[model samples]
Target chain A: MKEGKISLEEVKHIAKLARLRLSENEEELMTHQLNNILLYMEKLNELDTSNIEPMHHAVEQVNVMRDDKLKPSLSSEKALSNAPQQNGVFFVVPKVL
Target chain B: MTEEITQWSIIETRRRLAKKEINAIELVETYLKRINSLNPSLNAFITVCEELALKEARYYVDHPDKLVEKPLGGVPIAIKDCLCTEGIRTTCGSKILESFVPPYNATVVEKLLQAGAIIIGKTNMDEFAMGSSTEHSYFGPARNPWDTSRVPGGSSGGSAVAVAACLCPGAIGTDTGGSIRQPAAFCGIVGMKPTYGRVSRYGLIAFASSLDQAGPMARNVQDTALLLQVISGYDPKDTTSILKEVPPYCEEMKKPVRNLRLGIPKEYFAKGIDSSIEEAIRQALRVYENLGARIVDISLPHTEYGVAAYYIIAPAEASSNLARYDGVKYGFRAEIPSPDLIHMYLETRSRGFGSEVKRRIMLGTYALSSGYYDAYYHKASQVRNLIRKDFEEAFLTCDAIIAPVTPVAPFLIGEKLDDPLSMYLSDVYTLPASLAGIPGVSVPCGFSPEGLPIGMQILGNYFQEDLLLRLAYIFEQETGLSPKYPSI
Candidate 1:
């Protein structure tokens, strides 16, 4: 967190967390690139926003509540229409255990 | 017939179809023929929707009476590939979803069809709408029609090219940090990113939920206005969608600018902007001044921090939004014979996403990861608040803000592709407006000395799209300038 450069091992660990496999070459390149970017992003620290709030939704939003009613939805078959791997009614995936 | 038909606006297309001066088949065939000849040079479309377009046109040809009720009946329009189309493969310019055929249509696409617009095709874009240039797309980079050697700005590059080249009368594009507006400026077309919740994002492939909004891109302002009318509204499914009533955009856009006060932010004209672009914007301001509007110099003190804050906030959202592409439910799956689910995820993602996508994902994941969240994402979000407040205070003194859409004109295709930071910096002008969730329009102001199209951005308060459109419409109508059809 101290304005330090991101290490190569840290880049690989982040990639793993994101479920992405990077070539050793890509990891090195990304580590360098991300450092340059994060360094530039340090410009944000120039502003004093101690009293400012973190803004998420640009406009005000409310948790929309609707009357629960039975409505038509994408049929189970239609929902599975684009599944890369699927059985008769469900998507197929690698064993969790 | 060939040249004239390809340039017909939605209004002209509707009139001609109604009079039988041009039938749907003739119109569709004319554009299809042009696309076949021109698309190869520009690489504008990922999928042309040829059969669907012709079929939709054929329906109107058979049912002429129905045209009275449909506003955009028989008009050809291009959609960005990121928006889902029921059966048309919706690849968000990533090989991961190269064959993704969404079972439902994005709300805007559904709106287009309901208005009787023909789905001409889905345009190419940066992978998952990540980059400022289309060079990151999996299929190929979409070149600027103006000069095939240059980029057409992105992630709506192909949509901009499609309209600029007269391949389509209108196109729809999504903007999350200048995707639509930058491309529109680069291609010399009119593009708007409405107030964030004004347009529904029901089936739009999520990039950064908070910043993303689909908008209209067209050859001129009124056509852009008409297109916006069709797509603007609330949807029960999109909870973030505002429950406000849709305005009659074409009518509201006709208001004169006699007493209008336009703000010129001092920070926007600072370093990094091309001298010619600054002169062109000042020149455009003279046109508005001559038309009886007042120009006021203002300050957006937090402007410099926009790119930095946006980089942190957008990727942070994207890292979460893009987590859905894990290879099981839909889209690409790596073929490695690994029984481990985790390995399968890693392989699928690694092989599926392009370099820019990976870079952002990692940048985002690292920022949101343990220990760095408060320092990066939180700090950036607070900076975002300051930027938004800057716009709010500026609007109090002026009706709207005017600035250049990008710091520079469209660069050569490979010019900044290798340097991610530079490419990110190019979005400086457009990102502040986007972060504020305010409505903004990009209209052609002047051409660069090299003849590349330059767009002047008009930013207004939230849900002020009609005012944005009106000012842009007056500027466009007064100048009567539209980019010439690229020789390609």
Candidate 2:
């Protein structure tokens, strides 16, 4: 967890993985912000948590669930009303390479 | 008496229903009227379930005997749009789901319905619960009920505002980072984010699954306890949902606060915090001290890394969680004349989600992407473990931790909307609680000079919500500030 500098290339790469088409301005801004964030996280590296086992659950908890029962469902029309583009049961979309 | 019904607390509302002072229909009407009058300016609700709420209220009137089983019995409340309410428009404030009505109620919503709580409406939120301000919502930003020019700190902005404006006695808000607490703080209401797994996330649209939690937002501590009592418990549908024995949250209210230990994390009050907020927290600590609770100085050294660690971890998870919203599924579908799935996804997502959400999604996607996973996302999780440990150690020293919910009071509508970094900092004080999966309650502590609400957060140990509620109830009583509703 070294406090190494995060470059614009890293931001661009992250965006690509995220499938985001970021403009040049956003990439430049994010690089500056993300780097500062990393520098701050570097301070956390100084903390001694070696002896403490990593604790994920704040309180011990087990399977939380509901009875498997069919409940009243919404109409297909209502369900798809929010779709920006739809064709019957499927949502319509643009072409990909 | 007309306004009395609308302004009553959960207890009073129930009491009136029992005494037949006002029927459920009248109760719903008063609130509907208030919402009708005030919601135009506040923009607190995206989908107002007026007809359904009225229908439910009328049913309660005809079947009063059923009230015995319903703990929330006839109390009207709002649900954050992110939580799917069966047959209701459960838009997470994005155009992608703008017309989408969920086929099922989120587990919490079902629980609320069973408890006799009337579904008033779905409140607005930052689109996909991504921003500190609800400005990113496609519907429009929720205005602070106290001051229209200022924002009701969001993504639960609408829910908090609805409760604050007396449109609903209480509301449910999902917290990812500080969505619930920040808006609750800004709106000057009582809001609690129970231990991460304390409540089920079955129907809650994911922001960051690990960090997301749903909790009650109310006008006072006891109502929050009441709401929590109903909505909390184990749900198998949500894999991350914790199965734990449900405690009588309301029963804890009767417990007296004496000889309680409160911890003040010094790092939270460090440089960059606003003076007024610091003063408000100090004043609240004084109230706790006056109540005979021992206030001790404790250090959560890793607190400084909160905003940074949260950015990496939240986005990384968000990028993945949000990927399902592609055109093929239920949400916004982009028009790809050439019939390419990838192009459809890109076009739909690009057109559906807002800029800030897109930014975080991109950042998260990047962090979780190959080659960068270890350096960014994995490293952040490790740091998260350390952050959790910091609270564990602090709890060993004190019963609870008290701090300001946000660095400053609510800012103007457009104040930091453009500055993502500053907006990210808004959750600096509150993120640690979510990261560590601890319970935190934000109660109105004081008001700023310009008359904005300031809230102080109470952080408690895991499954220590009883202690958290008891302590908050005591402080709320001592301050005589529990029932002060914001002037609309």
Candidate 3:
């Protein structure tokens, strides 16, 4: 296997890195699918882009600064309104430390 | 009143509302009734905000003078579920955000409401705007109104269906890689993807930040121009939005289409294209020729690599943009794993996202992973530059490019579900324009032998929507095909 391409182990590793857990069957199926897609993405190698610069942003942008002024922002209640688990003042999640 | 609501455009609705021909409430009700009756079979909407729509309509009943400044006044519109609607359930067609209600409306939604347009509902789409077919939706796929068996080309399939069936006068859809155009082509409506940064993406759920753009969908070119006029302009909220002044698109739409040079890229008309769709585009060109416009044969040599580059770039951006849906955020959080936060995060996303979304995440992560970033993401970005150069050089000689939106018509719902590569190939014609950060529109040109619709793609240089809409308008006037209801 190449350094970047996907095997079953590589698929599992990618899923882990992506914060996803695929079942055994899913990992196998995904390994197969990712290999096919990666093979297809090789078509981009046909073009010679040796001297061309990589285009990142679609539009060319300079520094975009805004006036630093007091603005009304979303309240704590409103911001956390859609949280699945939340206390009155804070969003509740599983322990980190 | 029912007869009129079936074909009422944004402009016509405004004129009639001002003349007291029909009240706003009644017009909204007629469309709402149609959506209620037809949405059961079509499944075009994820959430139908009937009460909210009614409340908005009642405001116009008392203060009729407000219609003067509001061009889309009293017109009922549907929004693709990807855009946030304050106080409305915005699922983005994914279970991760299934029960999530936004506290703020997307900038496009804000513009639509300010223009006095009543948002009737949030239309279904591919989950998080990822699929070429709307079948990826967790809410289930939206059926094509033309043929209930065939798929509505998507990620914006529901919006296309809603407008095609006259459920609403117009709708808004976001496009990263042909999301808006392909569905618009399939449903026989006019859908446009504005140049990147033309419309504000302030509250839009990010798919691919660089390629994602919101545009208008309607039954005809004139209504599309009107809708585009409202949503475009500079927004400080989105730093990438251009600071240029927006032109009067509706006024420019009335101008002549004579002497305009339309470029027909040979790559679009290559051997792999469906013969009937090619013929339909040729016939549309003949219409342009008769209208005193000239067609030029051009070449976009880098066209073959578009899907490859897009697949690499879009998913890479998606993997990053969609990383926000952890268990801690405002969307859905699963409870299966409880040992620690990492376990909970893994379980929640694994269960929350469907197969297609997971596929993209994996693809993107692999492309951006260690020891592979240069080979995949960087190489594709360089290829993207070459593709943009192709359009830049093509536009030097041509006023606008005329081509096919999709190489083939809409396929069956489950035909390409198992094979992601085939589904990705279906967007070859539209992907290049998206990659180049240019404007493109899919206007209904003809139908296939099976009676499904095909759309002709017209792409313009960045922020030159007026010229593109004008060309589409002239074609619509000549063909007289759109603005008719499908036999639902």
Q: Would you list the C-alpha lDDT of every candidate in the order shown?
A: 0.92, 0.84, 0.91
CAPRI accuracy category, model 1: high
Candidate 3 wrong stretches, greater than 4 Å: A1-5, B1-3
After the best TM-score superposition of candidate 3, give how far the Cα of residue B464 lies from its true spot, in angstroms.
1.2
TM-score of chain B of each: 0.99, 0.98, 0.98
Predict model 3's lDDT versus the native. Answer: 0.91
lDDT of 2 by residue, B1-488 (tens): 65667788898889888889888998999999989998999999998999999999989999998865588888899999999988898889998887777778899999999999999999999999998888889999999988999999999999999999888999999998989999999999999999888899998998888889999999988899999999998887777777679888888866887788899999999988889889988988888788788989999988888887898888878888888877665776766566676666667777778878887886677667778776667667777888898998998989999999998878898999767878887889999999999989999998888889899999998888998899889888888887776666
| After superposition, candidate 2 runs with Cα above 4 Å error | A1-14, A22-97
- Top-lDDT structure, candidate number: 1
Tens digits of per-residue lDDT, candidate 3, B139-223, equal 9999999998889999999999999988888999999999999999999999999999999999999999999999999998988
Model 2, residue B299: displacement in angstroms? 1.2
lDDT of candidate 1 at residue B6, scale 0 to 100: 81
Q: What DockQ does each candidate score versus the true complex, computed on alpha carbons?
A: 0.88, 0.36, 0.83
- Judging by lDDT, tell me the better candidate of 2 and 3: 3
Tens digit of per-residue lDDT, candidate 3, span A8-93: 88888899899999999998888888888998888877778899999988888988999999999999999888888899898888
Per-prediction share of native contacts kept: 0.93, 0.45, 0.88
TM-score winner: 1
Per-residue alpha-carbon lDDT of model 1 for B185-211, expressed as tens digits? 999899999999999999999999999
